[model samples]
Target: MRKEETVDYHIKVVWHAISRMYNQGGAMKGITASSGFVLLNIDQDEGTPATKIAPLLGMESRSLTRMLKTMEETGLIYRERDTEDKRSVRIYLTEAGKKQRDFSRKAVIFFNDKVREAVSPKKLEAFFDVMTTIDNVIEENKNLDQKIQLIENE
Candidate 1:
């Protein structure tokens, strides 16, 4: 099958397009798509734990650390030691970060609303279902490579 005809290829292409769109939008606010994503995942009420932000954003911890440092340097975020867990740190948005988060939220909502207006609700639901099924299938097969082996007797 042609690469363009593959499901993974299409998914990757669509995702890259979406990421580029977000990055373009984010650039206006001096942020990247990745930074905006991390900002959105952080809780607005109480601070999010430093350890949890990476998982919430589906990011590597080392990468997160760098982003967090940049945000901190830019006065967008600050870290505090958790009162309950002395070893743990919580990340809190600065006033600037809150503003950036609001911008990010509005941008995302606008994009979603536009897509919703263009796509039928039924089709959107099916799209979500297909994505969920793909995730489940991939998750279930994660150990397949380690567990399965095919060989021919010589």
Candidate 2:
């Protein structure tokens, strides 16, 4: 096979493995991954405004709002009106959210172990670096029209 075809095949295989792991895992249910990720990200940057969280996650504000509402109903997160900015709400994980975060951490460790068992440490590290680079490249290539649309929709 040509080099490009080989690269595409490997990318598909990696994505499939990741999808399967997330879907089958107890802690990281496929449907809830986005909410979990947003929760974890908010935990890392506590007190971040809700508006900012959606953009950082590359998701729409409406979708994030729905996710937040679900999480709040589940007792996983709490939103408080920002003291300095009454119109803006800040997100914070509740006790249950912390527990979810712990579960996600363990799930990621389990997933990493599975990967390590299948691939060498060096290869895993390389794969991680390559994926990060690809993400960065995509972010950097955002066009003016896309940016404008994102802002307009917000």
Give all TM-scores, in the order shown: 0.89, 0.68
Worst lDDT window (10 residues) for model 1? 145-154
Question: Which residue pairs in candidate 1 collide?
Answer: none
Q: Candidate 1, residues 1-154: lDDT per residue as tens digits?
A: 9998888998999989989999998887898888888889888878999999997776799999999999999888899999999999999999999999999999999999999999999999999999999989878888756555532322
For model 2, the run of ten residues with the poorest summed lDDT: 22-31
Which candidate number maximizes lDDT?
A: 1
Off by over 4 Å in 2: 1-17, 27-31, 144-154
lDDT of each: 0.90, 0.77
Candidate 1's C-alpha runs over 4 A off are 144-154
Q: After superposition, how far is residue 99 of candidate 2 from its true place, in Å?
A: 1.6
The top-ranked prediction according to TM-score is: 1
